[model samples]
Target: MKHLTETDLRAWLAVIADPLATPATLLAWLEGPLKKFFPYQAVILGYGELTVGQVKTTHVLASGHDQVFLDYLPTAYETADRSSIKWWRTSRQPFFIDPENPPAYASAFEIDEIQRFGLGNVVAHGVLNIKANAGCYFSFSGVEGPLSDWHLEALKLMTPLLNDLLLAHFYLKSERSPLELDALTAQQRSIVRHLAAGMDDKTIGRTLNIAEKTVRNQLGKIYAQLGVHKRSKLIALLK
Candidate 1:
């Protein structure tokens, strides 16, 4: 596994931090930035399963007729793995599902529905907690090999980038009009993102490198301001 150079890492950070870049642009950025790190067809699955979002872009490094497959099985793509997707929701961790752990229809999944979709060997990373409120599965298939340590490391490196880019996107979107989200602090926004990701007080605290009590207090203030009583309600208000 080749380690990413400091200069390259810095370049990636700067790219993701750029304000003018949209998620579609960032998807393009990912294809270029991590080309050598993995071998698979990539798609940025937005809030829905299989129904590619507006952000679909592929690195030519990947070899697959992904677009053709998508066109042929559009309906199956949208609903085949909807329930399975929630696994990423609560764990908030990247999961690589293989033939060894293939989907079972008994588990509320439409197994035949997916195999007909013509995808193979899934590799996916979860994007936890963002404003505009959606969970993204950065996935790739059509590869031959167990995902390597380098692949996992690359995905891990991208997770926080995805978070911050989405943060910038939403903050800008919210502050664009008569409403001013500029008044909200960065910490407050971080709190909102984690809470929206379905994280509880303890997980949010650990992720933010703060105390659990601090997380609770932050949520208390956020709820009061948003006029919400539950986490779901708070997330709904924010979205």
Candidate 2:
């Protein structure tokens, strides 16, 4: 068993728990003080509010991850009916995952997330609020070593501080207009209307007389501009 230095823990907590810390400073903190003990190439933080049949992100941030990874995450696990996906539920314990051999009994959605992200070695942890049926999830990928009790312990120790920091970040606005929706070109708006109407990419392309791939690509831009991660959510936002 690798031993953890108390000094490492103390400094990590001190940096993350700083009152001055904000979303803008999170990447530096993660790559700085936190890396002293926990090393990773990318980290994703998501706060979700669960409903009867689905879990939706209320806020999300990805540091050192790609734009495609961020834009596709919300719908990666989505089902036709949006049924309950086990991975969406919280796990109080940390997960030590290696793509060569993943954690046991990992849900399909969880596995899909790993595969979709092209994640390397990962240690994931989260804190759940039972009453509200919401939680904060942390996924630290591109880890370089085997899973250890030390990594789990470090993440568990930092869970509360991380949760609070997530709450402090820019929340997914359920009621507000996204960053640049009003500025969308007419072509973009047409794509959005077709998407929101439940039309598939091929169908939308035929209607708009564009390539199917172009339709998909334009929808991606609409999602980013509207600040929505899921198609259903985007439709609701536009309504």
Candidate 3:
């Protein structure tokens, strides 16, 4: 790793104090100035506590991710026995997962999940909460090549600020979003959950025991009520 330029250091610290920070802003920073030092082709972020898993509180950001992979990410990350978050907290070091050469801590299921998503060479670190449970965590996938010792060291500089940006407001799922979930009917709510879980209309229809046409029609109504025009936007809000 090279020395952090004055520009890079400034860019890194400047974001934590950004009063108008949002996930879009954070993504810009990550894909922009931050990438110069900490390189990754794709990244996933989780905003919540440790020792517990819930899709509602998870926020994942990955490039070119399909719906099924997005739905799988949070569950795979929260694997208590083998997650990088659990490994890092317990070992006080950054954790690494390589698909072809799995680490001792990497579970078979975890590796399979990563491979299934087509993400290679995962490296993870986090900014834990008061009790060192969890505040936010991140995994940088498809790293250009080997992640060096210096790369892990670089994470020490950035994780907290990234966590700050994440917890403050990462995206639609942010606590700040004014979701009118109460506006939904019970069936609509179920559909929304299924959608967030990466179910397509046909699958949702099967699950709800409704015709595919009805699922599409109800989705139209749900979209109108929620002010989202597409499945991706709707999932972003609820996932």
Candidate 4:
């Protein structure tokens, strides 16, 4: 990798510092300008509500790859991506995988499936906002060689702004009132509020003077009413 020039550094800073930049715009910068320095065949930015132990909703914010590859991500790819799951649960650091060093967290079957895509090398970062129960994954793939120190440094510089943009998108979505909330009863609404506040079911139950099972049952109904399947989605919907 080439050393980053002062002009290049300033340009990067300018793009990320733009408060009004959208996810698409930031990704465009990555795919275009940034690529000149650290070339990659494809980049994928996945964002949406995520729950511990599972991925609830996955939106491909950006992709410079084949549609078939993009389509597979939400279902087959995600189901088999143990490294991402582990990263979400245990670590915030960026991780890399390549033909030489496949992800240990993945099963042999999973590795085989991924290898079929021919994405040579990959570096992924998990962006999380615990308060909103939302997170994202930014992945750069299809490079020829191992990522250099400068490449890692560039990624570190971009992380905060990417995270802020994702969280902003979440907040914007949350500002709109979903009509589904009207279907919830008073007690159910209370549970939804507690969920948004990042309280666990047990804590909510204690606060509401209800049994834990009752809280769970109420949450189930709330989920049905809101057409959501996980606590994270529920929080996203009502938060």
Candidate 5:
């Protein structure tokens, strides 16, 4: 199949816009959309939960041919990029895997695992942090190279919808009912919201029309209020 045009992508997304669309339908639509946008032998969507020092995989969706790849996932995969996509749930920035430009923190063996899992030529993108400490991952793969801009944009266009779906997924599966935070002030809530949406301090400040230093000060207060020491922790809290 040919790659999707912007118009075609928009239409495809619109067809699945029903808020109550079943999970099976969502997965079915996504499989066709992903294959149309990028070349890959198979695709899978994995889900998990994160504790302070542990990550637990709860669910996984794979096209029929790709089930064997899950054998490579283990607790050691919790480092960052390999963590069954749970890292993206708490990250404010988009995590990308280009294979050609793997991040510096990635090790030789980690890279090997990616290749072995049939993910070496894949470019994965994270959507947003949602209920029950979950996020959605959009991954595109090819036979021998990284994704092109067209491919990225096609997936990017689905991010907003993807974020909503993740929240719904968590809300359906979670049992303990997420803890509601009472420490945030109104301004702090606004700040946290912007930060959670992947805005930097400067961007948050500009959007809120405050000084960047003021944004930092607010973030410091927020961190203290939420009992977090860093942005990552703060993100996890917000989720």
Candidate 6:
């Protein structure tokens, strides 16, 4: 791996710190300024399940790769014991694969299949929110040597920001609009709006001139109607 100069590190940090940076914009930075340090030929980011036989990319950004390969991921790519999924299950740490000596976890068939795509190295890390029964992944692929210690360190440094941005992306994608709030009654909608404003049930109840128990009951009904079990999930959906 190449060593990043102080300036390079600062630039990478700037990209990560950008409050308005979307996943696509971050991906563009990964492909450009940070390429020298990470050297990935392709990249992907999204949320889904691997253990339950469901893999989907709610958001994806890739370069120097075919779209067909990504399109096949939900079906064909995931069914196989892909390296990323296998690693994600066993450990929370990032994992990597190189053509020289692939990990024992990856099946020979999977290795051959990956190599056939002209990829020689790959690295992946996952952020699991078990309560949500879902997780997010960041995958980087290269056509040459394995990722180096610097690359791993860089990713580790950026992991927190990546997880935050990825979750925000997921929430943004799934957030319901005001029109979608029609599913709830006016009172329920008012409660939801208060929740969105970061009010607790007690505070909301007091403000709305209702008892806390009433607020709880209303929240239960709202949760049932929205198919969510927790206040946080409901807030994310409504946000």
What shift in Å separates residue 167 of candidate 3 from its native position after superposition?
Answer: 1.3
* Model 5 vs truth, CA RMSD: 13.8
lDDT of each: 0.55, 0.72, 0.71, 0.69, 0.60, 0.70
Worst 10 residues of 2 by lDDT: 76-85
Number of the top lDDT candidate: 2
Comparing 1 and 2 on TM-score, the stronger one: 2
Off by over 4 Å in 6: 1-11, 18-20, 50-63, 75-80, 143-146, 174-176, 179-239
Which digits, one per residue and each the tens of the lDDT, describe model 2 over residues 60-149?
A: 777888888877766323333321234434344677767678666465565666777788877778888889977787889888777778
Between candidates 1 and 5, the TM-score winner: 5
Q: Which residue pairs does candidate 3 place in steric collision? A: none
Candidate 6 lDDT, 122-234, residue by residue in tens: 77776877776567777777734645666666776667777776677666666665555687888888898899899998999999999999889999998888778998888
* Better model by lDDT: candidate 2 vs candidate 4: 2
The TM-score values for the models, in the order shown, are: 0.44, 0.61, 0.59, 0.58, 0.50, 0.61
As for candidate 1, its clashing pairs are none
lDDT of 4 by residue, 29-90 (tens): 66665676557788876676655545666555655687877667653234335654565347
Clashes of each: 0, 0, 0, 0, 0, 0
Query: CA lDDT of 152 in candidate 3?
Result: 70
Q: Tens-digit lDDT track for model 1 on 139-227?
A: 66655465445555666776666655544544554342323334446887798888877888899899999999998888777666665
Off by over 4 Å in 5: 1-22, 75-77, 80-95, 100-105, 127-132, 143-146, 163-239
Model 5 Cα lDDT, one tens digit per residue, 1-239: 23567687676566555443454356565556545534565555555555664556555555634546656545234545455344444453344455667765445665676677656555466553445654455554443354446555555655666656654655564422224345567777889889989999999999999999999999998777666799997776555
Single out the weakest 10-residue window by summed lDDT for candidate 5. 173-182
Compared with the true structure, what per-residue lDDT tens digits does model 3 show for residues 147-198? 5665676677777667777765555335423468787899998998898888
lDDT of 5: 0.60
